[model samples]
Target: MTTRAGLITSVTLLLFVALVAASALAQTNDSVAAACDAKVKAPDYSLPEWPEKAEVKVFIVAADFNPEQIAAILTPLRNWSAVAEATGSQVTFVYSGPTAEHQDCLNCLTIMRGKVHDNQKHAAELQATVNQGEQTILYARLVIDRVIPNLTALTNAVAHELGHNFGLRDCFECRAGTTVMGLIRSSDGLTGPTRCDVAQVRRVYDHVRIYSAEVKRRKPQQVAKIVPVDEGEEPVDDDTPIVVKKP
Candidate 1:
């Protein structure tokens, strides 16, 4: 998320952020940076890109704690997917509970790397929202004692992190006025992408563009195929809850 770290000392500017925390639902190990700092590598096209007409399927991984609650949260994701699809992008939500076959198990960006150990604590970031181009993938496993009481809280956390999985930079509400890719701070953490984050997924999907599916193995892949921004589609306002349905 775009957080203005402590700005230079100035008499007028008394507020300056020291360190903005990232979102907890993002890639635990992979997401560490915001935008590409080095260079923008041209996407290698081997397989065909996502067809505008075809729908993109995504696999979701949910916690075993509460199946019913998980389903409820997914409904909003489905609706949000429609928003992206209508903008030349499509998404198909896949549940990854009980069976996390392909999805690398959602990871937590907030989790520290050195804090690795076995303690029935599921320390390994086993939950994250994976995205391939326009295809957005989410693995919802965050639960207290296996079940969550506040559905609204669950939706807010997961959906915000999913936004990062789609490659949109996370930022504070202050940045929303300037860039579409603004950082959103939540009770989870800051939102940023690391080397193994968006770029890696983008590479794999981009490869599919040049080469046909003949060589590509049809194992269980995440999401795929996202078209450019369509005209007249305004970005969702920051305050709009991603997972809650309006009454």
Candidate 2:
């Protein structure tokens, strides 16, 4: 039988251990900020040659959210700059107070179509097809809300959702593991969709395919070591932090 004082000491020790673990996880989450060389060496991602110029607009409905929350939501927006440059496109960000007038003039398209979306207008206009449908848009909402686990998960959600609008459907293996589209549904254990997603802007603009035939040709090459399972080692997951690219 443990004494009361002894029990309290054990509890305190457990709490301290838990806090230490949480701190370590927080550091891991900020891995991108620590990168010094990621942008420099990637063969695929350089200053993407603009076939013409891409016009990407981000309309964030942030009225209901606190400014601090909005800032957190925008934290991943920097990745958009990288994505845009890779695609040879220009990006426009639309958010609270500053873009109030533009909301009235905004084009009606999907923002997100979840039960609780960051923005309502985008939800109302979201349209999905039989092949690549509702779930794609829903995943983006989860990313915006930061309901997913990591930066990889969030970035995957955005990339997947944007894929749906373009007419690309979920990839085959994406239904199981850590794909940009698969992570959301697989993590939740849901049925897979039938169709694929495609890019809408390609009709009028020079499209840089994201995870498609073109981007497939341009996908990031593994500069770091990749041990195959046959070599008595497990293959590295893309999300694994292997080589710290020092910028």
Give per-model CA RMSD: 19.3, 22.6
Local distance difference test scores for all models = 0.32, 0.31
Which candidate wins on lDDT? 1
After superposition, the stretches of candidate 1 with alpha carbons farther than 4 Å from their true spots are: 1-63, 96-149, 175-247
Which candidate comes out best when scored by TM-score?
1
lDDT of 2 by residue, 108-164 (tens): 222321332322111111232111211111111121332333434333444444433
Please give the lDDT score for candidate 1: 0.32
TM-score of candidate 1 on Cα atoms, chains taken together: 0.33
- What CA RMSD would candidate 2 show? 22.6
Q: Estimate each model's TM-score.
A: 0.33, 0.33
